[model samples]
Target: MSTDSVLRFITAGSVDDGKSTLIGRLLFDSQSLLADQVAALYHGKHKRTADGVPDFAQLTDGLAAEREQGITIDVAYRYFATPARKFIIADTPGHEQYTRNMVTGASTADAAIILIDATRLDYSEHTPALLPQTRRHSAILKLLGTAHIIVAVNKLDLLDYSEEKFNAIKRAYSKLASALDLHHISYVPISALNGDNIVTASAHMLWYQGQPLLRLLENLPVANRNSQLLSAPALFPVQRVARLDGSSADDFRGYQGRLEQGSLCVGDSIRIEPAGQNSTITAIYTPAGQVEQAQAGSVLTIVLADDIDISRGDSIVAADSTLQPTRNISASVCWFDSKPLNATRRYWLKHTTQTVYTRIRQVDYLLDVQSLNHRQDSDSLQLNDIGRIQLSVQKPIVATTYQANPATGAFILIDEATNHTVAAGMITSLV
Candidate 1:
């Protein structure tokens, strides 16, 4: 990875699962907070318990809803820099009503930290109502979209810091991970609220030897050009059409848009899809000034060599690598509406800048997260219910399966009457 690129990670788990405290520990013990900020946090309760330790989760829980209720309700972003790397942590809410919030956070994350309470490792007991654990097939289902994982079996103090207890939880979670085809997951036993084995090593777990949590985060392997940047096709989705009032002497026009994929440079011949227009890059202008070249992830306005009817909601791609365009597709939909997925219903599909009408064609199977099996006869999926749905759109849109390209695989279902987001979906298989 280059210095300009940033690796984003999201923290997820059940309510009271210690997500906030873990993140607060990462920031505080790494010396990321300033003196005044630290002082404010120190005086929150104005007194410490007999343990003489300040509650670190106080740092991240700033909103009154979070502080008063003592639970995370919204996504909070934290930024910090180490000598070797820069990091962005997206702390998402864990309540079932906020499953949409979890999806909102995880969509851009390169990794996920799944925190599990060691004391609440009860598999035999069933949650009385299905609503309590909506869409969770255990932790695995909540995290299948994530590329990498770090399972923090937190609150080890409640377990007397026992290695046996930690290992049991680890083994069980690992088994569920393997069943879900979740890869590259590592585990650590730590007490989030107390800050042991997170930013520093612990004396209680003398038998265990490994990098501390902060060290693990700093050294985690990140993929570079060879995998994500270079191998994929060049895609430039028009976010906006930058028009400069009038045309030149001969009515010369240029289509302005940002590069959304691989590098695009001057003199490179590209084709605009759906329109089938051919053009060459004539100029690249960053807000700073004109640049001779640009690469993936850059937001620059461009000028074309030939006249083309390019507009927002359209895409420009490399001549040789045009992504498949489709009207019917299969997606992994996480139901976000209070009402169940009305199978006989239709909604608006928003992909990038384009919005089209769409209808659910079929519901293949819903996942049973714990066992990671398919619950075959699901009639409907209510709020936070995740299931496989076949969709038929009114117009063709460009998208690849998430495994191929995450940004391209995304789409949104909007309620036509309310204009509210009703579902968050990822294109799992483009049919």
Candidate 2:
């Protein structure tokens, strides 16, 4: 069976909001946790309890500090399977200090579970408790742009399983989502610790008529977010060059990489970037042998008509029509460094199958998370801040807009000084 059926989702929310317990319940109800693992939760040394019952959250808070503090300090990953689908879950920390870890975990997620404390909203005021003083707003601002979110309003039982309380937080967050133009969002009221409305319908929540969390996750339609991008240009970034054998097929030279966009068929014309040399796909070689065509996510070594020089870091793109290779450019960036992003600071810019030295051109502006307003002429961007800026580069690299194509449009900035990935960027309108 193809692993594509497995959905990769991550849990993220504010501190003391029950992310770990939610994960534990998912594991337990799905019957994915091992017998020993569940037993250890009840009797382990790290168990957190005043009574004899196991603190279910201990299933994820295995760290000494996390157990001592009764909170998650870092990203916790787990895997589980059901007959319908498999899941790779990353329960990300919600503390202000670990916002970067949250971003890292959510970056590749197929779905984002935004855990909201059901009782945290003021129903009269119709607003949430915004942490203006901390990085929570900053973190939410970054995720707003890219995530397909599930607003899981957890701890509903704490509010007496009141649907009104659930709706209050849901309405408040929906306002924020609307202001950010996010529409494909769903709300589920769940008590993660009790497994109520998590894997099964809550006997107490008679007000709800929707599927439980697990059913929703399993039945949610899986579609590539960038399916439309394939209709336009095709981009194949060469990952490596391969030789079949010691002496056999010595004449065979193939360029290997996963197809990034569009489709590639044998006899279709293509080209290598920066070099801009033209060629045709003589053959598309997969472990399944040469097929007539290939699409996005195809991992194959392609044989070209020309023996012209090619290597890793070189891209195979559609010939005749091509994408521009740029170095001096403007981009929308979400700042992830604790130290403010400076125009003078330098970093390594990683694009599709390539990396180059780069620096910021200008710190143009930052965004207001709650209102979606621009802080134009802003002074600096601290960790978790979302901003737009022009970047100067040491060499050219291929890219697309976050709208046109996300996979190739996204990139990370690695700090040259410490090797930490300090920023994420999406091409807005290339300059």
Candidate 3:
């Protein structure tokens, strides 16, 4: 399938906010389910609704623990296609403990659907307060640079489809969005159980004039990496160095990796990062054969004119690219491990294909997810904590600010002793 024709999005909200049910409803209503799937829903051991209808949430709550507890625990991915667009939906856990899973699912999403349960709110208040998980998910989405956000106010049927309650919840969330500086937001009242405002318009509430959830998704524009100009700086992180055995006189070496950004052409002058070695692109080869040029997202083997030492974890970029090699960096990170972040502990900082030993220079501040406030007194970050911190790597690495280029700018921290990933971070600036 063409990359441009696909849209990747995630459904996130507090536990029991109807994320799974909403996805099941979308798939069922769009006629994307097969006969066996439909039969399993009806005959499955999971309990049905009072009206004897199949349990929609059972379709996505595939894990035994999840089905037993009726809560999402892991990131569940589902795929479906409509006439207008193809969709890859990630159903993420809403529990705070699984915040890391949600971050992993949303990292690549072009858009996000944040579900808000109407039953939990007190509509009598002028501005209904949103749950903390709701705020946390929104904050992560903003940090990940998810361009489009849809506020799905779910279970409105329980509120008798009250327009006032929906408006109150919307008002409360609007303030939160403004504080977080989130943009391109759309609000829709939905009842995943009753199939309202999902794939088609709901007859129960004519007050909402916006398009149904499916229609909006079908029309939302997908981010096309190729849309950038050809002259844009290119980033190619070498994944592997291929050495082919040819004739005794012919020695062949090729660098294999994906073009993360911009373009690469034959005869273009390129520089290897960290080493600062310059070379000319002698040839470019794709799976099909040699190519004169390759754009972003292409996986090809590059043969350079010079035999300068290059290997895995090294990056190749246009010689004129402005990216700087730095050893110190300031970044915003979301701590995922149960153990708090220790300033003196050594960690493995993996960026692109390169993994370097790093130390935390300082914990600048911890961000309050609910209020979007930064606490300056924070010395360490605990599980599910988002904070700004400075890090010093053992070796210089080429990188840019996350806002400038996410592919080359984001990285993960791994515990050296345990080797488990402890945090996900985005480069804010090179220090």
Candidate 4:
């Protein structure tokens, strides 16, 4: 059964687990790469790996430093298509320093292909040892709401392409997956460097009766985009003010933004949050034509009946919605900066489109990545640390819990002095 759905997925694992090589192999075997991309492998800088083939890892590890260091430092995204499906792959960095990059890549992914190097594990027994990053990334993927998880047992060639070894690794990961409550978990055995069990069934691994990697992706069901959005309250974050024909004679003003959640219709009453101004939708504008109704994910211009003082960073939400506007936020934050998070220091908090001054009122606890438990003794958090923290904002923000509405419940902490993103946060509870 062929499915033409587009799947957005991320490949994550510990450093040198072959995340980039897997992507390169997928592109190469699928005939997805252009002629020059393949030809360049024969020339400049792109040297072959030990297998005497063009370095497939070079396809996704595009940064100069990454190439020089033989690592992936940033999130390198690549797109390819088979007749049955189209795919967007985010090959994220596996280094501890770039954990934030992995978080960013998995945040929007529908599924995650987490690679495990067979060479590193003692797979003679049923429960093989797992790398720390494997468990950590699995937890992060679950936290980010990735719907599907595929534990790809990579580099089986190193293990003599043994089915028993693959089964042992699968059994080991299953225990961890069950602990994390990850429902849609599957496992596949393949060597990305040798192109076995990737595009087609492997002759070396005849015992693996499951479909190839490409086939599994081709038939994987993608969750409907509209269903989740429609279940949440309508959210419209004003991007910019649109004035038609630059004319004030008619006082024409339209607010433009992508409808982030739910559906909106003409004559529907809505409230502009933080200001609490109420108005009725006078009209909706789209490139095709004017419409009386618009669904989530649509980018449209909305005209309100009453003249309201709305600007960029303002949220227009359903009038009867229960989303609370608050200055106190308690969230699970992943600290991204080299400097530890200081309770006495203030930051630039950005949520949706609103930016305001904020500070850590309290650090509730820090998470132990290995055990996935909370430790309350920490006074501050360092780089790549995930913790529960309370934030006091200078202005009230209209937000919902991330479990309820992801679009309105997420935010980022930025350093004002250097203007770098320091933390990524998801609202757990608000006061």
- Return the candidate ranking by lDDT, descending: 3, 4, 2, 1
lDDT of 3 by residue, 1-431 (tens): 23447899999989889999999999999999999887766667764555457778778888988887878898999999998889999999999999999999998898999999999987667998899999999988888889899999999999899999999989998999999899999999999988999998999889999999999898887766466534458889999999888565689999999887889999999999989999999999999899999988789999999888999988899999987689999998999999999998899999998999999999999989767899998899999999899999999998878877788889999999999999999999996
Best by TM-score: 3
Candidate lDDT scores, in order, read 0.74, 0.77, 0.90, 0.87
Q: Return the TM-score for each candidate structure.
A: 0.89, 0.88, 0.96, 0.94
Name the runs in model 2 displaced over 4 angstroms: 1-4, 62-65, 119-124, 131-147, 225-230, 243-252, 290-292
Residue 357 Cα positional deviation in candidate 2, in Å, after optimal superposition: 1.6
Determine which window of 10 residues in candidate 4 has minimal summed lDDT: 43-52
Every model's Cα RMSD, please? 3.4, 3.4, 1.9, 2.2
Output the worst ten-in-a-row residue range by lDDT, candidate 1.
Answer: 126-135
Give the per-residue lDDT of model 2 (tens digit) for 55-129: 678887868899888888777888898998888888888886777777777767777787877666566775655
Error of 1 at 199 (Å): 1.5
- For residue 67, give model 1's deviation from the true position in Å: 0.8
Clashes in model 2: which pairs?
none
lDDT of 4 by residue, 312-408 (tens): 8888888998765799999988889999888887899988877999999989999787776789999899998888899999988888887667777
Segments of candidate 1 deviating more than 4 angstroms: 1-6, 45-52, 123-145, 225-227, 247-252
Q: Please tell me which model should have the higher lDDT, number 1 or number 4.
A: 4
Error of 2 at 111 (Å): 1.9
Minimum summed lDDT over a 10-residue window in model 2 is located at 130-139
